[model samples]
Target chain A: MRAYLLARLGWAVPIVIAILIINFLIIHLVPGDPIQALVGDFPTPPGYAEQIRKEYGLDQPLLTQLWLYLVNLAGGNLGFSFANRQPVLPLILDRARFTLLLMLPALTCAAVLGVVLALAAAPRAGSLYDSSVTAISLIGFSVPIFWLGQILIIAFAIKLRWLPAQGMISLRETLTGWAAVADVLWHLVLPGFSVTIYYIAVVARVARASVLDALSQDFVLTAKAKGLSGRYVLWRHVLPNALIPVATVIGYNFGYSLTGAILVETVFAWPGIGNLFIASIGNRDYPVLQGIFLLTAVAVVLANVVTDMLYAVLDPRVRGSYGKNA
Target chain B: MAVQPGNILEIDALSVTYRVRGKTVRAMNAASLTVRDGEAVGLVGESGSGKSTLARVSLGLIPRKIARIESGRILIAGRDATRFSETEWESLRGDPVAMVFQDPLTYLNPVMRVGPQIAESVRRHTPELPLDQRVEELLELVKLPSVVTRAYPHELSGGMRQRALLAVALGCRPRLLIADEPTTALDVTTQAEILALLKDLRRRLGMAMLLISHDLGIVASACERIYVMYAGHTIEWGGAGAVFQTPAHPYTVGLLRAAHAVRNAEGRFATIAGDPPNLAELPPGCPFVPRCSHALAECSRDMPERFDARSGDPHSVRCWLYEKPGLGFDRAGTG
Candidate 1:
């Protein structure tokens, strides 16, 4: 297991470097100048653009610029954002925490809720309750996240007045400690649920199909013939086999949830990396964009590694093969 | 333990129907059979002969929504098992009756270790015993090595896995064991070994066994009495020796012929001429009328009921030719 983990980490280094190179190239390849975007529509002095370009080392050749960026990245310097004029790494770090706070709960909620609903519906497949769950999940899967966020805002925030309308917290409150935490949670409901709806639908459908398949297996019949209660058979024999694929789906979705959070964050005006992503795109802030892309790539790779390890733990067949290879 | 002195399993006129695509198919039709204490009864049939269905029904493992008992009685250990609820069935399953399935790989839970799977049965029947000791005891009873307990189903070979399954079936100290093609998935040498092991275990444990298989040779070797099924009906049944020697029913004759013809050096084999009748659209008369060479006009006109094939012998056959009215058919001269 240790050797396997070390081998995976070894592969991750080159992949991350490849991602860094691609991200740098793509951001530079776009047909607009960051300097021009920064200067805006105001007429400037003749040497002003050249002076700014030289100051940021943008006057160097593309390869030279790439080398400089790589050297700075290796030293843990994410460079400075042209839009905010601050270190890109620290700014992303601040925003990333908020993004994680929003995403972690939503992801967990989706997984738990989806599995429970699927389990309830799977046994009586094609019945009224199962059909109802299927229809609701279909709607959740098909409806756009932005539109769903708006609908939620209109219903709970506008008509029902059950939750706060926007932002991470109430700006007017000077609250701290538990009061502050409660206020933040209160504000999170709409965006968090909206972002989670699609994932919930995806996960629930997968769980239902897999669990149904598992229940039909001969092993389940054997478990039943062994005098196990229906509940015991389901939890012990059915769930572990059914949940293997579900776990992989959940792992892949962890990285995918970030892209989904972008729209929800914009709609709710949440102060997270998704919001920062959009603002940086508009300003042509290459450093911040590269930093965010790099972070996402690293997170996705790590999630896949963790998922593989989980597979080994959950299935003895996989563990046996892994042991042989290691 | 000495063998208990009554029928361990009894099925009387048991008929099972399955609803498939809005049509009800009789999977097992009024199949009556029994296994006495410390006896081995073999059920032999082709793929759709309802042998497995009878085994499942006796164990109360049939899927309720898809299949239903149209009219039947199942008595296990003198208890009326026909009206058993799910909970009642659960209580009866591991203790009074247990089953070993056809395919060991499919029957054993892939994610579980062989040891814990057997231990689960032990826990169900005798929860007071320490689990590790009970598991070891069961494993040893099946002649599996102690280390096999820690191995998963995939880690073991087909023969070893089948042995592990037998260990599980024996864990509950069941009075009756239903082995549904227990050695079918094994190779030739392994099949012989398993058959030997089964006979040895039946003697040691003093449990009645209902062994279901398609192979006449396998059933002949392992069981004292044999029941031959054809298209959801018990066409013939008797002492294994008598049935194999006489084979009064045309279907049983064909099966015996096919079993023997395989040994011909020319690689030629006799086969039953046509397919078994579809359960949903069965003929009004006998199910085997379409495929039987000796089928009479009366055979296609009405179903033949069971009749004694030989005087003073328990051997019975469901053929109109064997019906008593002094037909002068000369049954002993035919086959």
Candidate 2:
């Protein structure tokens, strides 16, 4: 456990550093001036433009700006948004829960549904189930998320009246507790389902392919010969091996899903980091953009770190295989 | 109720065909045999010799993706298994007959602990027991120290895994056990130990077995009767004692000679000529004719029937050499 933890910590160092570098570069090198935005038409006004720039530390050297950003970042002060003057951390925290609440369940649902479909389709590779799933996934992969979201909104929300078309639940409703929680879930259906469809499609395809490969392995045959039920053979023998390939995609997809969640959020006008990110990018809000990007990079790295720890937990060969190889 | 010393499992006209290269390949063709209670019947053959197919078909573990049983009767305890539903097959598994596959490592689920895996099989048979007791009993049955069950497949040695598989197979108190090359993957010492353990288990449980292996010495030492298969055909069948003492079929003789223990290095390998015929493009007559040293024009033109090898019961060869046909010993088309 200690070794695993240490290894994860070691892997995180480079990612954390890369995020710092990329965050600084993206925020620093961008056109237009935050100082100018802060004080409109102050540019070319001698001593006036200089004063606002000095006040915001925009007059500071590139290295100094980076140093300030890094120091404040370590201390949990993500600086203030240039356009809104709101603390970046507060803005992010206010929106983070909503994004997580939406994405977490969507992710879980996608994973479970994908696994079920994949397992069902595994035994019938190239048959109707396989072709149908493959075709569905192809359509899914090709669909523009914004278009898909709009289609869902029209079908489920406007035409059918099965769901609320827009707006997250109010704070007052959520504060009323568990009943409000149920209300949020009911409201969550459209956006969640919209996000999940893509995940389900991709994960299902991956899982089906992996399990098909696993079934052809000698070990799966060995498990069947042990008199294990076909279900047992699938759940115990095939799925575990299948999940190895699945785990790899899960780590990478966490990033893809997190960033991609923005497009859906924008379509539904849902309040998430993605929506916040798009708003930031449109206005060229430097602090908010930097904060969200940094957080996302960190989240992806963290997901990978956790996945690394799960390696030893899932596969003993991975746990000790490298040691033998070394 | 003790098992009477006869007829435990029967395979009648068991034929398994697989599609290969846009053509149907007969993996096993009209293969018939029986393993009597408390007896060991060795299905001996080289790779792709229908031996493994017979084992799988009899167990209902056929690979439905490619392989299909054309027409056959696999009767476990005089009951036709072809008609069993999935649920019925599940209920019958590990209870009436249990199968242990070739590779030991592949037998145990890598993700599962040894004890729990065995306990699962045990619980399948007797699901009412406390899990702890069931686990302990399985560990004892397999003769492993109880602590070994806590270990995963990667943790246990290959031999230990085999023993655990044996325990799982024995869990339901099966009337018959099918072991397909139990010791093939193990080292010499481990192989001997597994062989001995299997022999002991058979004697103690009085469970009949269809021991599927290509190794003649292993069969000669462990099994009582041996059924020799070639290109999906059972070319020779008889008691192991009689077959080894006087191998009837040329393929059987070649296999016996090919075995490392029977033929020492100084004596050059008496390899059978030509490759075993591809079942898809098998010769018009006997499947083994392409490789048989005794093959004649008649052998290629017509299939042979079972005939006496040494004028004894329980010893038969499917070769015209022993029949009152147009050919006699050291002669061409003249008896």
Candidate 3:
């Protein structure tokens, strides 16, 4: 197990670096100049743009700039955002917390709701409840996340007025401690739910299929014959067997939601990295974009590694295979 | 004669039907059998002969949605259990009755350690006992090493896995144990060992057993009495030696011939002609009539009820040939 963990962490290094390189190349490839975006659209003094460009080391050759970027990354310096003129690390870090606040609850709720509904539906697979669960999941899966977010805002925020339509909190409130947390959570409802729907559908669909499969396995018959209650059999024999695939979906979606938050954040105007990411693209702030992309890549890699570890934990066969390979 | 102390189980005219696609197909048609206290009974049949269905239904283990018991009585120790609720059945299971299924690898939870799988039943039935010690005792009872308790199903060999499954069944100390094709999934050599172990456990533990098998040889070695089923009906039943030596029903004869043909490799391998009738569209007569070589005109017109095939003996058969004394088809060892 120790060796497996070490091997996974070792593989994560090159993958994150590769993603960083791609992010750098892609940011540079876009057909716009950061200097022009940073300055006004009107013509600048001839040497003025050159002075600002040299100040940020942008006047260096492409390869030299790439080399300097890698060197700075190695030294843990993310440089400055072109638009904010602030350290990119602190700027992205400040927004990351808000994004996490939105995502963690959404992911947790999605996983719990998915597995619970799947367990309820699997035993009565042909019943109306099963069909309804399948149909709702299908609808949730097909609807676009941004569109769903808008629809939720319209219904809950505008029409019924049950929730705040946008933002992470009621900015006017001078709340603190518990009140502050409650206010933030209250404002988080629409966006968090919007983010949750798609993942809930994905996880439920996968979990339901696996649960049905687990129900039909021979061990399930053995469990039933043991006089265990249907609930006990489901919880002990069926759920554990079904969860490996559900965990895969949950982990993959959890990682993807880091970047996936863009639509939800934009729709709700939540002050997260997703909002920063969008604004950075318009301002052609390469450093901020690259930092967010690099962070997302590292997070995705970490989620996948954690998912692999979870697989070993859930299945003894997988754990044994990993031990042998290690 | 005084009534025997109530057979461990008495399945009377048990009929089960499965809803397939849109049609209800009868899986077990008035099948019946009994397992006396401490007696090992064999239920022999071809595929789709409802052997497994009988075993599963006896334990109330069949899923209610896929299959339903159309009519019958399942008497457990003289009490009618046909109307027993799920909760009542649950209590009865793993205490009065427990089952060992066909394939251990599939029947044993792959992710669960051997120790816990066995202990699940043990804990429920004997919560007063120390769980660890009981688990160790079960593993030892099945002739497995104590270290095997830590391993998962896939880690064990086929023979060892089946033993672990047996241990799971034995953990409950059930009075009546049902083993449905228990050795069907094992290799030939392993098959003998598992069967021997099952017989040894039955003898030592004094549990009544209902052994279901498609192979006549496996059942004969481990069981004292045999019940023969063809397509859903229990066509013949008697002492194992009587049924094997002077099998009355043509289907039973065919099964014995098939078993003997395999052993006698020098002779041409004999196989029963024609497939078993489909339960969905069975003819209004004996199901075996279409395949029986000695089928009479009357056999195609009506299904015969059980009749005495041997005088002063318990042997019985569901065949028209046994209705009269001078039927030439009653000759033994024709196969």
Candidate 4:
């Protein structure tokens, strides 16, 4: 098992490097010039542009710039954000904490809710509860995340006044300790729900289908024939088997959740990596963009590796194959 | 005092039907059989002949929503069990009766260790007993290695998986065991070994068995009485020796001939002409009439009733040919 995990992690090294190169290329190739965006429509004096470009090493050939970037990366430096005027690593990390605070809870809640609803609905595949869950999931999956976030704000924040409309916390409050935490959580309500609702639908549908498939397996009959109760058979034999596929779905969606968070964070003005990502894009903050891209890619790859490990833990057949390969 | 039935299972004229895409399928038209205490019985038939369905019905394993019992009575341990609820059926299963299904690779949970799969029943049936020791003992009873308990189903060979499944059934400490095509997925040598194991276990445990198989030879070697089904009907049944030697129904005769040809290493082994009738749209009378070479005018008009082919013998057949014993004997050229 240890060998198998090491092999997977090893394979991820080249993939992360490839993503770093691609992120750099895509950012450079875009039509907008960081210098022009930085100066912001002001008539640039003749030598000001060249001086700034040379100062940041952008005056060098693309290949040379790429080499320097790679060298700096090896030395554990993400360079300075042109607009933020700070080390990009710390800037990205500071924003990442807030993103994680929102995303971790949203994803965990989505997965838990999805599994619970799937368990309830799969057993009664054609009942009213099943139909209602199906309908709710379909609606949640279909509606655009941005639109949904806005609507949630309008409903809870504008109409009912039940939640704060935007931002990570109330600026007026000088709260500390748990009070500060509570205020942040209160502000988190809208964006978190918007991000989580869509994923809940995604996870629940996948999990429901997986549970149904597990229920149809021959072992379920064997379990039932052993005089095990239906509930016991479901919980023991069905749920673990069903969760294997759902784990894959969750891991595959981790990247998409980052994209979803960008929109939700933007709409709510949450001070997360997603909001930082948008601001960096507008300002063409190359160092921060590269940092965020590299971090996101590495995170996604790690998520998949963790999922594979979970599969080994859940299924003996998978563990055996991994052992053989090792 | 009321007299209790001596049989461990009695399925009397049971008919089970399934609904599929707006059509009702008669999976079991009127099948009947019994397993007396400590006796092994074989139910042999072609695919879709309802042999497996009969086994499921006996165990009350078929889901009520998918299939309904049209008419019949099932008495388990002399108790009227036709009206048994799901809870009653659950309690009855793994105690008075347990089943080993076909394709052990599919039947045994792939993710579960062999030990826990067996202990699932042992723990339920005998909670006070030491589970680990009982699992080991059950494995030993099936002649599997004690170390096999730690392995998953896929790690084991086909024969080993079947043995593991048998151990699981035996863990229930059942009075009766229903093995539905238990050896079908195994190789020929493994098939013989499993049949032998089943026969030995039945003797040692004093447990009655209903061994379902399409292979007549496999059944003949393990069971005392044999029931022959075709198109969801029990056409011929008697002592295994008598039934094999003097199969009364033409369908039974055809099956025996087919089985015999294969056993003799005959290339291009004989198969009965025509396929079994679709239960959704069966012809009037006997379902086998279209395939029966000896089909008579009355055979297509209406279904025949069961008759004793020989006086003072339990051997019986459900065929118009059996309406007159001498006539059926003359046609089959057997006695």
Candidate 5:
């Protein structure tokens, strides 16, 4: 167990460093300067621009700038955002919470719904129910996240009036505590549900195929002949064996979710790090960009390590294979 | 008379028809048989002879929601088991006719230890008994070493696992046991040990058996009476000694020839030509007609009923040759 923790920590450190370097390079290599982006795009005098450049240390060479950025990062600072004047880490953290409130519930919902439907429609795998689920999944997987977000906004929020339209919450009360929590959940419904549709389609199809294959194994037959009920065979013998594949998909999807893949976040106007990251690219905000990228990189690596650990817990065979012999 | 003759299992004219690609496929064609107290009967067949299907039906392990008995009866302990409810079957299966599968490790749950598995079945059927005593008795009965109960299934050797299964089988003190290719997964040495253990259990407990296997030699060694199935039909039935000494039907002859050849290097093993008939596309006459070298011209024209050729012993054959000769009947690989 100690070894597992060490290994995970080992893989995560380099990932953060790599992301930091990449983020630093990308923002620096951009055509425009952060000093100019902070002031304005107007045709100002070269002398005025040069002083602002000097103040921000942008006039220094690339290596000197990179070294100072690292030193500043080491001194307990993430730097103020060029766009908002807020500390980068705090801004990113607040946005991450909002995105988490939206996407996590949707991800979890997708996993549950997908697994249930897949198992129910598995035995007659190519039958009407299976095909219908597959077709629905195909649509869910293919439809653009932004388009889906718009459709939900138009149909449910505008036409049906079943839900509120744009923005994070209603403009009525002081948005904090209970009201804040409820408001986030309510606004999150459309974006979260829409994003979840893709996961559902992918997860359910994977679940059904795994279950069908697991049920065909010799162990299933043995379970049945031992006088266990059909339902028991399905729940015990089939599901545990079937879950290995579904778990893999869900784990990888969890890592991908941390990247804050931009489409859903933008559609919802989510103040997530991905949105900040994208804008930073345009304005060449090197410090904020590197901070967000490093954090995200660390998150993805940690997620994979957690997934591997979860696998060993769920199936002893995996742990056994990892140890005994190989 | 004779303490009510503890005939533990009875399977009468049980037929199973499966639907595949919108067509009804007759997997079992009115197959009838029985197992009385302490009698080891072999349901011998080549592949696709409906041997596995028959075993499944007997155990009520068919996979579907609305399964039809199709026709016939299965009586266990004087109760009609043909339409036994799931709950009723669950109650009766482990206690009355515990089944031993071909592979023991697959039969035992991998995550569970050897002792707990045996304990589970024991607790299910014999709930009144104390745990340790019940386990120890079972271990002693199967001739497994005492420490086996604590070990995981993977820890034990193949022979040990088979013995462990037997201990579980014996946990119920089942009147009849179904050994479906019991020794098929083991080496020859381990095979001998398992067979010896089974024979000893039967002798001591008077446990009747319904053994299904492709190995004629194993069946001949273990069973008292033998029933030969070919293409869903029981083509021949008699004592094991009689069947082996004088196999009347062509398929039985092929099986005996195959088993006998394995013993000696004098000649190539005799083989039946063609694959077993597809259950979905069974021809009108015998299921073996396409593969049987002894098939008649009329064999494909109509279904062949039983031909009880040998008198006074119920030794039967399903073929056209017994009725009349020279309708282009040719018995190859035989006299």
Candidate 6:
């Protein structure tokens, strides 16, 4: 297992480097002038753009700029945001915590609810409950995240007056300790649920199909024949086997959720990395954009590696195959 | 083998139908058979002949929504199993009766260690016993090494996996073990080994067994009584020796001939002329009438009832030739 992890890390290094290079090239290639976006609606003094370009090292050739960027990146400096005039790494790190706080619970909820709903629907597939779940999941999957977010805010925050709608917490009132935590949670619900709904649908459908497949397998029949109750058989035999594909789907969906968080955070005005990303894009803050992209790439790669390792742990066949390779 | 009072399993006119796309397909038509205590009964048939269906029904493992019991009764250990609820079936399974499926790989949970899989059965039936000890004992009973308990299903050879499955089947110390094509997926050598292990287990444990298979040779070697099925009907049944020596039904005769042809490495093996009947569109009379060479005109018009093939023996055949005395003599001469 250690050897497998080490080998995976060895492969990850080159892939991360490749991703960094591509991300830098794509940002540079895009039609945008960070200096001009920064100086928007201002009468530029003669040579002002040139002075700003020279100040940020954007005056250098493309290759020279990429090389310097790599050198600065390797030296643990994410450079300065052209718009915010702050170090990009610290800015991302501060906002990233909020994104994690929101996303982790949302993803976990989606996964658990999806599997539970799927399990309930699988045995009675084609029945009213199954069809209803299928229909609901389809709607959840098709509905846009921003639209869903607005609808949730209207329903819960405006009309019902049950929960707070915008931002991370109540700006009007002072809160501390558990009250502060509760306030944050109250605000999280709408955006968190909105972002999670689509994933819940993806996971639920996968869980349903996988569980149904597992139910049809001969081992489930054997488990049933062993005098185990249907519930026991489902819990022990069906769920574990069915969870493999579901876990893989969740891992891949992590990257998707990051992108989705941007749209949802914009709608809800949640102070997370997603909201920062949108602000950076509008400002043409290349450093911050580059930082967010790199972090997201690293997160996606780490998720995939963890998922592969988890597969090995969950399935002995996968473990054995790895052992043979080792 | 006489009709005994203390039969471990009894299916009385049990008919099962599968609902496929709004059409009811009769999978088993009033099939009835028994396995007395400590007796080994082999049910032999071609594919789709309802052999496996019979096995599944005996254990009440058939899917409820898809397959329905049209009419009849299933009595396990003289307890009417026809109306057994899910909880009742759960209690009955792995204790009074247990099953070993055809494909060993499929029967064993791939992700689970062999020990835990067997231990699960032990825990279900005998929760008082220490799990590790019971698992070790069951593994020993199947002649598998102690270390084998820690291995996954995929780690073991086909024979070892089958033995592990047997250990699981015996975990509850069931009164009857239903082996549905237990050796079908094994190689020639492993098949013999599994059969030998099953025979030994049956002897030592004194557990009645219902061994379902398509191989005549396998059934002949392992079982005392043999039931021959064709298309969804129990066409002929008797002591294994008697059934092999004098197959009364043409389908049974064809099976035996095919078995012999394979044994002798003949250039061309004998085969039943047509496909098994489609249950959805079954003819009014006999299911085997289309393929039976000795089928008479009335055979296609009326279903044949089970009749004694010998005066004093318990052997029986479901054929028009066997039912009419004069016709039986003439058919016997032709053979």
Query: Quick one: best TM-score, which candidate?
Result: 4
TM-score of chain A of each: 0.97, 0.91, 0.96, 0.97, 0.90, 0.96
| Model 2 residue pairs with clashes | none
Task: Please provide, for model 1 over A157-247, each residue's C-alpha lDDT reduced to its tens digit, 9 standing for 90 to 100.
Answer: 9999999889988888699999999999999889988978888998898999999999999998788888889889888889898888888
Identify the runs in model 3 with alpha carbons over 4 angstroms from their true place: A151-162, A173-175, A324-326, B1-5, B262-267, B330-335
**Each candidate's lDDT (Cα)?**
0.88, 0.78, 0.88, 0.87, 0.76, 0.87
Q: Each prediction's TM-score against the native?
A: 0.95, 0.91, 0.94, 0.96, 0.84, 0.96
**Weakest lDDT window of 10 consecutive positions for candidate 5 chain B:** B326-335
Ten consecutive residues with minimal summed lDDT in candidate 2 chain A? A317-326
What lDDT is reached at residue B268 by model 3? Answer: 68
Q: Could you tell me which 10 consecutive residues in candidate 4 chain A have the lowest summed lDDT?
A: A252-261
Expressed as tens digits, the lDDT of each residue in A175-244 for candidate 6 is 9999999999888888888867888999999999999999999999889889999998999999999999
Model 5's C-alpha root-mean-square deviation from the true structure amounts to: 4.6
For candidate 1, give the lDDT of residue B101: 95
lDDT of 5 by residue, B142-167 (tens): 88778987777777899999998888
Model 6 error, position B286 (Å): 1.8
Model-by-model DockQ, in order: 0.79, 0.52, 0.77, 0.81, 0.27, 0.86
Best by DockQ: 6
Quality of candidate 6 docking, DockQ: 0.86
lDDT of 3 at A77: 95
The true-versus-predicted C-alpha distance at residue B138 of model 5, in Å, is: 4.1
Is model 3 an incorrect, acceptable, medium or high docking prediction? medium
CA shift at B43, candidate 4, in angstroms? 0.1
- In the predicted model 5, the residue pairs found to clash are none
**Predicted structure 5: clash tally:** 0
Model 2, A1-326: lDDT tens digits are 56666777798988888877877886767787766666676337568878767877878888898889889999999988877678999998788778888888888888888888899888788898789988997787678888888998899888998887776774553356787777778778888888888888878889999999888877666555556788888888789878877776776777555566888888887888888998887677777888888888888888887777677677876666556322
Q: Mark the 10 consecutive residues where model 4 chain B has the least summed lDDT.
A: B326-335
